[model samples]
Target chain A: MKRIKKLDTPPRFISWCAVGGYEEKNGPLGEAFDLCDESDTFGQKTWEMSEGEMGRCALNLALSKCSLSHETLELLVAGDLQNQCVASSVGLDSFGAPFLGIYGACSTCTEALLILSSMIESGAVTTGACVTTSHNSAAERQFRTPLEYGGQRSPSAQWTSTAAGSFVLTSDEELIKNAKLSNVAISDFMIGRIVDGATADGSNMGAAMSFAAAESIIEYFKESELKPRDFDYIVTGDLGKVGTSILRAILEERLPSAAGKHLDCGNLLYDAKRQDVHAGASGCGTSASVLASYFLPRLEEGEIRDILFLSTGALMSPSSVLQGNTIKGIAPVIHIHSSAD
Target chain B: MDIYTNEGKKEIIKKFTPKTKVLKNTLLAFIFGGLISLGAELLREAYIYFGMSEKDALTLVGVTLILLASLLTALGLFDRIARYAGAGTLVPITGFSNSVTSQALDAKSEGLILGVGAKIFTVAGPVILYGIASGVLYGIIYFIYLYIIR
Candidate 1:
């Protein structure tokens, strides 16, 4: 590890950005959230979009902003929180990018970014797009019983924010140079460990995300060999308030003495119980949508540096959990570069 | 603004460039759509908190969902959710609304009975057909495999 004060950012990580969402008022997310419903009082606003339409909107947004034709992309790797990658199916139909539907639960965005950046960085591929979107309505139907079925939620549960978000990543030199996002560091650590067949009831996502987030954060520290204060921010996936506290307490209990600033997408998205969001944010799209609304601009503005983004995912299987199979979690960190020459 | 398929409205706004309008002038769309699902959950919780049976809760949730769905479709709110939330908002019951309206509107262009009455059933028709067909296929396959194995 050479101590280079101000390392010149790499040419490898240059990507374009595009956003679409239903407008919200007075909230950071409101400005960037892509809308699908106006009457939906809870987060499933976009429930009217067929899986394909949502993806198409996101892809078109990315295309329009990047000014890249559909033919320009070598491959479009994307996924969604919908069961069996249904949303990705929608984006796949029209976008014509070679499709890759991924489901690492809510970690889909970071996961897509991981693979896309690696492909571009290593020169295995070029001019690729990595995107993921979560439609609130689609998710509610699949995970919870039908919205019409009106199901009870536990205190530990987090409401799914009605939103869809996406980003396009590439190794194109021109875009990176022009946009002023120079250096890029994709964290080499992939939290691929499972809980050795430990079973837990995770009907509510907070508990599930908490366990996974805790493991990844702890291991990221060990793997990167850096303290909490090394980076300006450590953003976790949508672990709303309760899970945020549980995760921090777990970390505190684990380290007993570690300290610094830590935030979760769920906690940062809104004012906990009082604001509309919820107690513990849990969803594959949670981190992605919120980050698009909040984090992306900050990176471009040079307000932050070296974001140690640990996107967390909880892998729960239908038979595995009921038949007493263990739940697994993965958290992969990437170093985001937003500085210029 | 009907989202699931192409509509005459899209033709009317063929040159409208909804990208900016869709992105800009729709705060209520974002807030209400985002919160609607949460509201459903909260309603369910309110029911359960009063010790409503899970079966009863399920019924209440269903009624609430359909009512929301009907209200949303009637007020044209579902279109906004479809635009903003993308699949995020559209994945749930609001989708059912769109399905009904999309088919009905399409059928209206044809005629009442054949169009509205006949076409409406077309909604989820393929899904049900495929589901049943697949189930039968699986049943046959399972029986054959069981016989072969035994």
Candidate 2:
């Protein structure tokens, strides 16, 4: 099966927005986020409910950014790092659109983008949005331990970000002909193959997911004949410090140019040392919030030309990790570029 | 070099993966765990100084440690200290108390019976099982020695 596909009719990014909790609001790109709740609760009683609210707020803000109403959206592709994707389903249920729920663990954001872009390019769904979110407290309870549990984290363990991101895309003929575009679009994308790096330690997810990121980048490079220097940056989802180092070493001999252009959302989302995030940040929100607030804006404003955004995910449940199964990883790459020309 | 195979990628990951500071973690764990033990000893001595019997004092000290650990866990302070303390809080009665309390706190959102009751032992269940199993095995050996050999 072909892993890479170049969109003949790329979908235009109309509007985007990001919502984050207190920790994320205090991060480097804090000011860039569209909305933030200092309480991290979003006025909800439960962490799960708070995570759901983030998705709701992200989608609402994305639509309102361009003064678009709810009726303007025909489809909504959304996901979250919750069991059965409850965060997306329950959170986005109020939108009352034709919704398609997806799960790619932390890579849900890019996966949703890839799917939404494909639907638009197919001309089946001309106007749609993709939303994804993750909460640290919720993820900790489900995937690792209780939020209040006293346990020492490994140096490689990444702190989960409490955040959400949403993007609105369209391939409507009338909108395109009228020059109503956000100046950023999905040009091409490559769906990643699941790869296991043989690291069973759950705390060190970067090791578990690094192989998938390397493979996705390598295959995309081979298929498109595009070197790493072709893009301004090769942004990875949340491989954090450990995954980034391993990815660099792997790409050093193969895709040599990639090492210099590589950037991980995990490292970029937070001040690791100041925040006491051992390795860096993880979760679907880590990449989604970064892409929505940082990359998409820069692309829209034409500050950067293009980026190969790879949202990587470690597909491991608490049961799988406990059963001694190796964590599988996947990263779907989307070639997002400025369409200013 | 071979990114596809597990063994090939493992070698690459090992090269780039940062090594955990074993010496530092060990020292910290040792010092912290010792501190907890010392605190327990001091509590027991204080109880005895107040005219409590030695046995009663020891039991009271154990209860105090569990209570303090539970309160700290609820106040969300134990985990912060445990982050730096490593196994310091984990190897003592406090760690056991924390395991149970943390699970209970997490499950409380689900409900009373199914959430807190059933899931409370999620983390500490194994310890309880193995601890009792070893005790039973030792009791059997002691019984055999006392009746047959002695």
Candidate 3:
């Protein structure tokens, strides 16, 4: 593979939006979301269909915010926690853009963004959208047991956030100027390697993904010759409270000064005490929705200048777990900087 | 960070892992299970009032509850109820029925014989097999006792 380096001309996020189910909307960051459907089903027959509807809803919101139509979108890169990324495919089918369906498990948000930004930087597409979604019931049925099973959740297990988040990005300066939107550029990114923590227990996903998050951060710092303190904030995707602590200890050993700035999207997405979320929020939407609802706006308002957004994913299928294979994890990092910086 | 070493990684993972809430979960299960049993008793009493014998009422109530659970599972409502009710739903016969029906429904797409037919018993098959085995064992023991007494 070619050496990973910072982009020569970073692609800017022109607009973004997050839509979530009732539970997430009532959570701590609830008010920060762009839209919240009162019904988890989104008026769909099945939970999977509802998840698809969420993706469509988020994409529509982002497009509307930018005053752009589906026709104006050059490409659509999206994924969900479902097999074959069916949610994204079915959800965004109406949009008349070339679709690139990618999957990185729950880390799909940052992974999709990485791909979208790279395409724009390569001059392949001037405008594209990165979308990802996850539904609690749908994911539970697919990854673990059906909801009716009433299986006890391990304390280490995270509650999947029922949400979808989309970002409209562009290399065109005119799009931003016309829309009168502040630019949030994708400054740099590091694609993580699949790191196995040798964990066989799927319930302890936080432990499984923590090593991947730490490795990605270390690799990014080494390649860029930057310290953790260099970024205004270093946020990880879906590594809940426990995973965050593990990540912190790992980072502190190598980059002690920067470890303190670390925050986890999963931990920040909900209030653990008030909410029944044992290990806090997770899924692709955990990071995607949080970034769209909270951090992206903060970046746009210049409240934060630079961010190292690392979305970690535990890549395991039900069959893999059944076969006694250990869970392997990957975390893709995206460096987003405000134009004001 | 040479922490990628096996021992170092294990230590980091262990340090951050949270303890399971055994007390809370057990309490939830106990409460829910009690509620389900209470509901069953109420149903049985209502059946008795309608002139059915006590034994018949009890048998009818169990069948009625199982049927109701399966219907709810089909409508995609039982799972939602189960989420909140937790162990309350799982400890009852209704929970067992829901598990069977839901798995069958999930496998419907794979076709009747190979999919739903095969997978319908995936969760409940062991319980059913053991239930029959124990019932036959009790019958044999009772017969032997009667023969010895005679």
Best by lDDT: 2
User: Candidate 2: where are CA atoms >4 Å away?
Assistant: A173-181
lDDT digits (tens) for residues B1-150 of candidate 2: 777788887787777777888898889999999998999999998999999999999999999999999999999999999988878889899999999999999999899999999999999999999999999999999999999999
Candidate 2, Cα interface RMSD: 1.2
- Candidate 3 clashes between residue pairs 3 or more apart in a chain or in different chains: B32-B88
Candidates ranked by lDDT:
2, 3, 1
Clashes of each: 61, 0, 1
Chain A TM-score, candidate 2?
0.97
Q: List where candidate 1 sits over 4 angstroms from the true fold.
A: A1-28, A34-49, A179-191, A196-199, A255-259, A274-277, A318-326, B1-150
TM-score of each model, paired residue for residue: 0.62, 0.97, 0.87
lDDT (Cα atoms) of all candidates against the true structure:
0.58, 0.90, 0.86
In model 2, pairs of residues that clash are: none
Error of 3 at A174 (Å): 2.1
Off by over 4 Å in 3: A1-3, B6-8, B27-58, B64-89, B101-122, B129-150
Q: Model 3 over residues A1-341: C-alpha lDDT tens digits?
A: 53355888798888999999887888888999999987888888888889999999999999999999899899999999999999998899999789999999889999999999899888999999999999998998788765555455778889999999999999887887886565689988888899986677788888889889888887777778667677899999998977888888877788787698898989888888988888888899989999999999988888898999989999999889889898898999899999764
lDDT of 1 by residue, A88-196 (tens): 7855677666777788777777778777766665676667776676655556555543343212244555766545556666656676556444344343435344422
